[model samples]
Target: MDGDYVIGGVFSFHYYMHTVKHNYTTMPEPLSCAGSINSRGLRFSRAMVFAIEQINNSTKLLPGIKLGYEIYDSCASVSVAVNVAFQLSGGLDPVFNTGDKCSQSGMVLAVVGASGSTRSISMSRIIGPFNIPQRVADVIRRSTAKVVVAFISTGDMKILLEELSRKPSPPRQWIGSESWVTDRDMLRFSFLAGAIGFGIEKSVIPGLRDFLLDLSPSKVADSPLLTMFWEEAFNCRLVKSEATDRSVCDGTEDIKTLRAHTLTHLISTSNH
Candidate 1:
């Protein structure tokens, strides 16, 4: 509030359907589970809308400036996002307008979910043809808000790093908790450095494991071996050589600076 006005924009694409199944090789296997997206998209959209509202209502970083959101139902359709971008660049029609309080005003676009490499590449390419203003284009290009936390697996992280490496400017900075990394994913940390080869200015890895463990050690401990692997991988450098709490691994100070810089860039460029 006392500083720059930050416009928090959240844009998300929806998946219309998901199918799940299980097999029992020893016994008669039955197709067990399937989830439909008819209600899923709406539910996810509502949650996102509510989150933006809550953040704007409560957060100090953007006291006067409100959180804005746009929910585009890719509806599992790549064409829709592409079309939406074209339409938004010209300005929103009355039918699409959500009113003054909403973040969907004007054509300034922010993207959220691009579930996989293919979708990400498609969406990025679709927007590439548009001649959006530099600030707006920068926001769209550099955004990583919708990163798939679950898919932060070694394979996906490798793909992301490779993509970032090819960018001309790369991102100015990246921020994430160290817990986001794992032994198998150490390449991601190194990849962040490689992104610097492409021109990323800084990378900040926050350490949130202690905070998370403090809240629910049992639940976290119950998670798969991958979780521990990632925690240990990230903690290796930060943790005390002998102790387990890994207090030494905390990277809060560095994260704060990176966050400030990221927020500043977001606020400065958002209205463009």
Candidate 2:
């Protein structure tokens, strides 16, 4: 989205980043991120966009002035976050000519995200020198602390949950950050029952459900990100089947069946 002043955001959309082998003799391959998508991050990004649209349409806030944003998927890597920070700051490419249109619009008024502690710190360093304003851990096992306060993102918390799920630990009360406490996926662990934490207050945003369900294979045709999300959400291919592999998506598949409450989370919210 574009406006008079643009905000920058970085989120770990993917949990794993593919490691590329670089033979010093040849040009290195670009970083590739592969693995499960982070539905929380996707939800947060969408929320940001939704808020921006609301602000843009308001008659009072920033009246007559537009607000824009540029959001990036860090792929859960600090290096990628730093790279995007530079991009947001217009540090990656320096333009000497005054006629360059990109140089004027490239700089962001402020940067909003990069969820984890490490990634957020790295982004601060890159954008800090330019005086760009910003807004914006764990443990466990072993000892005998019955109360645990977790301050990690959903992706990082999943690792800890998997490790703990393998063995039996004495009942511990968990206090989670907003990131994982209300997450529907985290509830499946069963062991996390009775865990308590603060979550964003549930509220209805008019038209949000319809806006999210408004998707089709044709809309995702040019975007690889959306294609991946589409395949994961509907569990079907948008293309013709090869007779022996995954089934192709038929036009008859209805997204409305996924339930409005669940659709807010995007990819991982439903079993369908």
Candidate with top TM-score is 2
* Residue lDDT tens for model 1, 1-272: 11122222212223321222425456533211122222223333434444555567676755666545444444343344455455445555454443353433455435555433434565667653232334232453566653323333223344345554565333334443222343234453442422111222344223221222232223333432223332443443332456465654344323122344332322221121
Q: Write the per-residue lDDT of candidate 2 for residues 1-272, one digit (tens) a residue.
A: 56788888788889777776566898866555679776667766766776788889999998998888777788877667777787888733331111222334458888878878767987888633232433211235564788878888777688678877887466788999877887778877787646888856555667665555676678665555566676677778877667536588876666667655546567322221
Candidate 2 pairs with clashing backbones: none
Best by lDDT: 2
lDDT measured at residue 164 in model 1 versus the true structure, 0 to 100: 48
lDDT of 1 at 90: 54
> Candidate 2's error at 58, in angstroms?
4.3
Model 2 segments beyond 4 Å from truth?
20-28, 58-60, 91-105, 127-146, 161-173, 184-194, 239-250, 259-264, 267-272
User: lDDT at 23 for candidate 2?
Assistant: 67
